[model samples]
Target chain A: MNEYTYPIIAGITVGTALRVFMLRTDYRQYPTYLHGKIIHLSLGFIAAALGTIAIPSIMEKEFTAVTFLTLAASQFREVRNMERNTLTEMDSYELVPRGNTYIEGIAVAFESRNYLVIFTSFVVTLCYLAINGWAALGAAFVCFVISSLLMSGSKLSDIVTVELSELSFKGAGLYVDNIYIMNIGLPERQDEILKYGMGFILTPKSFSVRSTIANLGQRQAILHDVSVTLGVFRDSGTPALVPLIKRDLNDGRIGVFILPQEKDPVRAKEIISSVPVLENAIQMPSRKRNREG
Target chain B: MKMEKAILAAITTQSEKVTGSTAVFHCETKEEMEAVAANLEAILDGIAHALSDRLYIIVKH
Candidate 1:
């Protein structure tokens, strides 16, 4: 009777406090599929109750460490499950560069807030066991404190941050903001040159389009083809001229153009004249000058 | 052994769409694996829980 009393009280205290703490905190709001804290607390109470009832007939050393280890493993499993669930959810969002930093900080804050309570309860339980000699009441008290602290601390943090700046791309003709354009070359052979020499090639054989809604709002399904020529002068004794023509698409402001190595002045002029603002649209001379210098 | 069986049984009973889902377990030794298996078996033995559309395990040995 004496052995059972202390353990029973300890178990009850732990179980009740844990339940209360869970109810009072916002930990219940986090989305987790695993309910490990409940299991851990319940098991703690059961262990304390059993300890008290069997104390007189059993020695402290008679209790197997495997039992305690198993309980601890279950608790660990719950923690892992919760962490996995949270991470999986976060994977669905497009996060900015600094988003991960914010997540880490939130996780640290939660850990700091809960670690103190858990440590205190653990210490209290050890002290009670050492001083009260294997009695149910003392064991129960310890279990109650530990379980309560653990349950309250279980779900301290679970928030995800998403960012919106990493969605910028380039287009032709006009300096459109927040849009992506893909350039595909004609004759197919131009693909090898563009892919190996120019840095404007994209894999998977499709035009690139920005994935943001605010930029285009609606999808543009029309495909257009236009051509342009670039004039280059060789520094031989006299000026030797070379011309290059390229075919591309024009969408008012954004152009998806492809350039071939050979020159075609007539085709270039024809295609360039069709663009809305032809005078301002030509930029090859400036690009060439920059590259030469 | 038992726990793993229980968890597998539970997962099987909960959903049929468990093809791509993974289960991850951290085990250092055979003894640890056996212990985890036992606990898993106990939790999954007879209880029924709603299973996700797809659920799998990836053991992290």
Candidate 2:
């Protein structure tokens, strides 16, 4: 085989491996099925191949081949749309549906990650052809580190303090801390809520964070993640037993009322802390205020 | 625009308490009113909210 063939193979291998490493079937429960994984892996392979071949084309003085990257961009954008459609369709059946913001965030991640795969392959191939195989390996390691850092968004714990609160009822109203969640007129339903319901209060760490945590989509994402992890204590036709998040206008704190099947407050708090802060839900009102002042 | 929330039925012990376009169910006792409201909540797939000791209104959210 020729010199470019070995470099191309090395680049594709590294890129595909990076993609596999990134594609995790974690508690998020996405891409968990075999078919979903296959689709992503196939797309990752195509991205890797496209990235690796670009370097040799440039070396051979075929500048027209660089236009292929634009095609990759549009293709990856289609990946985002596919992810959005699939997640949105399935969300309706979820007990605690992941809001549109969370779905869009996931879709964006899928799209951006393909670009990262392309970048990783392009860098690896350039190193392999320019220097040697050893340099390519080193570059691949650096790419992995950078890709991980870029991929991971901040968590809820970074912006808010999650604390378990006593769920109390004032007449028929459900109260989590001082924040009123909702009302249950039925005493039987109220008893069921008391037996299974858990409440957590999230206090924003900063002024800007108050607005961010108050976003309806962000609150829904928190509920969805916790419900998925701990198992929700709800079913169809029982709308009164639904999980809800209510905000405190006085202190900019939020009260979360969840009815998980497993009544473990400790694990629930940990899940709340670990919930990813959705990119779209982040608001920086203080930044604008500071600039205006 | 579509109404996001509407009172589906009103179960009340006091006949004079609830008046509007919504359906009203008058109960003889507080127990009967509670039973009626609970059944309405389940059947209508809505939440029954108590306005007073005599009245419970089932609202779809």
Candidate 3:
């Protein structure tokens, strides 16, 4: 066997292991079924295989095999589209729809993970090519941590303070920490609201954080994540139970109101803090100010 | 005095007539039921708050 043989094997083993590590159906409950997991795992293995083989193929001067990497890139793009289409179809049936931005983020994450598998394999194999097998294994462990960190990204808690807020009704309008939510009509419905509704106040630490939460898409995501974590007290055709997130007109503070089947304010706060800030929703106003100066 | 969905259905069905009626909005606070009341008839009949955030206007007609 050639000296390169063990390096290829090491790359495939480490890279495939990392890919499997990424398969988790946590709080989001995405890819809810076994079939979905299987599809992604299968794609991950293929990605790792291509990545492991690329260096050796180039060393052997078999230039044509490198074209397969381009082919794999296009395949991952299709996977992203597939995830988006499935989520959108299911979202139409949800009580609190996870707006398109959140759906797009999930699709992007899945696609990017496959690319991560490819990257881990390439890096590990390159290390193997340069050093002994034992050293390469240690280097692979470090590579694993780096890959996971890249995928983790920043969370909502990084920029805001999420806490339980009082839910009150002033006249016909619902108020969460003085933020005006939509009006509530029907006495029994109001009774139901008083019974199971919970309110959360997300106070931004800075102007950019304020703008991020103010974004309609980000607010919708907060509602979707919270409702997904704690069951929604709503069904189709019951628009009254829809979750709402509105901002204080003066200070730009966001208030979230939801009628959850299980009203645990502590858990609701955790879910909000854990929510990923939408990349598209992040508003860097200071950048503009700097440019003006 | 509670509003019923039947009244809302009727008002929705007779929306064209309601539009022609004099619009004297009682509660100017942008509540949907208040708007519904304004659209149903000239006089502010009454306001009813329903299932958190849902506004309904029920007229005797």
TM-scores of all candidate predictions against the true structure: 0.26, 0.98, 0.84
lDDT against the true structure, per candidate, is 0.31, 0.94, 0.78
What TM value does model 1 have? Answer: 0.26
Tell me the RMSD of model 3 versus the true structure: 7.1
Query: Which candidate should be chosen as best, given DockQ against the real structure?
Result: 2
Q: What is the TM-score of chain B alone in each candidate?
A: 0.40, 0.94, 0.24
Q: lDDT per residue, candidate 1, A1-293, as tens digits?
A: 55445544553454445433543323222324346445434543543333333332244555564265355445544544544456446634411111222233333333332332233334334444456535434544565565455433211011111111111222211111322332211112222323321111111111222111012211110001121123222212210011111122332223222232334434433433332211111123345556889
Query: How many clashes (backbone N, Cα, C below 3 Å) per candidate?
Result: 23, 0, 6
Candidate 3: deviation at residue A161, Å? Answer: 1.2
Q: List each candidate's DockQ score.
A: 0.01, 0.79, 0.18
Chain A TM-scores, per candidate, are: 0.29, 0.98, 0.95
lDDT, candidate 3, at A261: 87
Q: Write the per-residue lDDT of candidate 3 for residues A28-54, one digit (tens) a residue.
A: 888779999889988998998899899
User: What is the DockQ score of candidate 1, to 2 decimals?
Assistant: 0.01
Query: Lowest-scoring 10 consecutive residues by lDDT in candidate 3 chain A?
Result: A182-191
For lDDT, candidate 2 versus 3, the one ahead is 2
Q: How many backbone clashes does candidate 2 have?
A: 0
